[model samples]
Target: MENRKAIEAGQDITMQKEDFAALWKTIHLKVTDTYEVPPEILWVNGSTIGTLGNFSASTGKAKSKKTFNISAIVAAALKNDEVLKYSAYLPPNKRKILYVDTEQSKYHCHKVMERILRLAGLPTDKDRDDFVFIVLREQTPDKRKQIIGYMLENMPDVGLLIIDGIRDLMYDINSPSESTDLINLLMRWSSGYNLHIHTVLHLNKGDDNTRGHIGTELNNKAETVLQITKSQQDGNISEVKAMHIRDREFDPFAFRINDNALPEIVDGYVFQQPKQDRNFPLTELTEQQHRKALENGFGKQVVQGYSNVIAALKQGYASIGYERGRNVLVSLNKFLVNKRMIVKEGKGYRYNPDFHY
Candidate 1:
């Protein structure tokens, strides 16, 4: 109430006189202080990636399986065990997880809930108070933040808060003031409630950087920033790496969506090509190799569009355990067409079954 009055009286909160009474309660610094470090709620290889009262983000391009990685994190929090090398240890008193989704329909949000439950090995049909899921897809940005604040206040036991699609909380992601304000809110909410907040954002198109001014602020202030990207070798696989971290960086890892639509680690998976040598020229394929590639890439259906052709060929090459980078994949597509291996029929390209292969 006093703070409200001060605001009404045109007082800036930061410039106001010190609240000496609250100093000791808020700060623990002393020359001889022996406070233990904050406990970690999320870990990779036994190294802390998420500590209480801090925020982190995961960013990727569109359809890069970012949500799948986040699902594992949320499931680990609920199960209090390791999921995809991410483990969470919410104190018994603070076992609740509050997941706020701002971009998906309610049905899709429900599907996400089901996915989390399944990943945690919990019954999907049962409702649990400790796991709260909410969708703000219809709400205005201001209202969405307001509702989240209200929910957080009411759910004091929440140990982990996830703001999936954090971009949706702002009217303009490019606004510098908005970016700073939003990041400040994250700091306040996380510290005020003594909880860890995990957020998700999309990478800028054609680049690895997170989107907008808000992304810049997030990188500067976040406890950790993780990047997820579709493997250049196989688009179906997503590799997660630490973009920024406060602790020792963990080894990069990859996961692929399985038949069950759940992400599973690609166990002992090795990429044939090194990252620095991705642009190496494509080697000529033998006639038998060409035949197999056609069988795997196009099968029977012929795709006319350029974008569609590249996608089909990627899956085809990956199916035959052939590692082809994006550039190489494009080159191989032209190579086959030029070699008369895949003949152009009308407007579409079709594999010639009897082209002297």
Candidate 2:
């Protein structure tokens, strides 16, 4: 019936699912079954930045030009061109992009649409069929989500979705149950539609972390968590860094809004690297080295807790005659976890043998 509504609304009925397997097949994984991987959507310097069937989040404090960065991304997708070093590619069947503005007024949403059009080298005076932008500020939280659901089901071949101000979809950002359900919805939507979703979130005041339990859940589950911060060296500039990514990290970059109200990359900006702690003989490991380390550390067993993870890795390092201190272990754990080589399971972490090299 839901699919009937979609078909009535002019969508192909092939995408209609009665419901996700509500029972046994949820846990079913068979070697004989073929699982198709989603194609990449965005990349930088040849490393993937976003892919279909996944979601990414970007966070910043108030007045941090979050929308400007997003404008560039939208332009990149619309033109299938490069914008500030981000290259985008979408299959012919899934070429449309949808933008949902939950916190902005109709006037503000119009300005953003114009900004995106100008950046994409399209006519700002007219709307393109491939780009759909809508504002949900007047709707209730439940209504906004329902509207998004309707869009997802009826909008034909939308490859990318941006939900600006995802917090507006819930009544309380701190509710653990709400946060969990929302995150789960994001995952299901992305995978079900074969699309990529990018979300915007705000940082907590007086702190660098994302706001509330929703932020925590996003940090743990998002495919990538990009943080936008005011440059320490130049407050006028905004820098983007990968707080966490499932792939290799990219070089942090900065951009400033220009006279045209479009974002321009800031070149030759010297970013200060973090200060190192106790010196380790080997501070970095290659991909193969990481795989070798994982083999030595886990030996096909789950290591419970942070302390155990550190101790196991220390032994793994010692076998290769390297010193593993607290700092190195901390950094290593974060790196491995972010790259998904080490997967968190409840209170423990286990080495995932399937981690791509």
Candidate 3:
């Protein structure tokens, strides 16, 4: 009512042409010649995983070694070396990489830092100026985003940004609106800063897919998506495959946790063997069949052994299950070797598909 009375009293309430033009000038305009292809910073299996001005994602089940694999990538970027036999090209004139952990505790985050440094061949005694690690486990979603934005804007030397727990930045992972907003923010940050942003996500337990709408949106927006899975034959080993890529598909690779607590690519690792008509399709078995197979004597023995190896890898000997499991696995491996069902390979044993367990 007061605004109406003011207008009636001849107040100037209309947008002026000069004011409108000033606002219009804020929009950036560029010619076609000014545009160029985004530079690829990280490559895996002939596919580009990290490209400047774009985003990528890595997802897997809990304790599937998603973070561990990412640590290897970060190490490669820092050292300007190859990761999993793929070249990691550093951004021009940039030597910094920022890693943000929003889920792990301070001690765990410190362990991650140590692992990255060790894998990158850096001495732990001296502080690193090129790599920045931030832990925001106690921060709210809003505060975390604020801090990330501030860092991206201020840290001009940081060419790569890693979000270890991307779900922490969203209020609800299943909300489509929230997922959309989160992806938009990520795109903006990647393009505005002209850097690569890699995010880690959790997968749904019941199936080999990411959690919710957030995962769907991320898969769509990401230029590359890497899926990490625990090996059924050897729980200590994790297989990483490029699930989606903007370019050509990359071959899969496998890695295992070394004694130094760093992920090392398994030597002469074969992801899968050639299909033979006589060989049973163990990899293509149904869920029910998988469960039933684990219930039988040999299957049960092998499964229990793998479980113990996984436990030892994750929790060490703190649990009696690890020791018991390892003993059972050793016995079972020997029996399988005698039967020719499994053969010893580089650092581990490989299952023979020709023989049914």
Full ranking by TM-score: 2, 1, 3
Selected candidate, larger lDDT, 1 vs 3? 1
Return the TM-score for each candidate structure.
0.71, 0.77, 0.69
RMSD of each: 16.6, 7.9, 16.3
Give per-residue CA lDDT, model 1, range 195-261, as digits (tens): 9999999998966657888887786678888889888888899998887777777888899989988
Error of 2 at 132 (Å): 1.0
Clashing residue pairs, candidate 1? Answer: none
Best by TM-score: 2
Q: Candidate 1 regions off by >4 Å?
A: 1-29, 271-357
Whole-model lDDT values for every prediction: 0.84, 0.84, 0.75
Question: Candidate 3: misplaced stretches above 4 Å?
Answer: 1-32, 272-357
Winner by TM-score between candidate 2 and candidate 1: 2
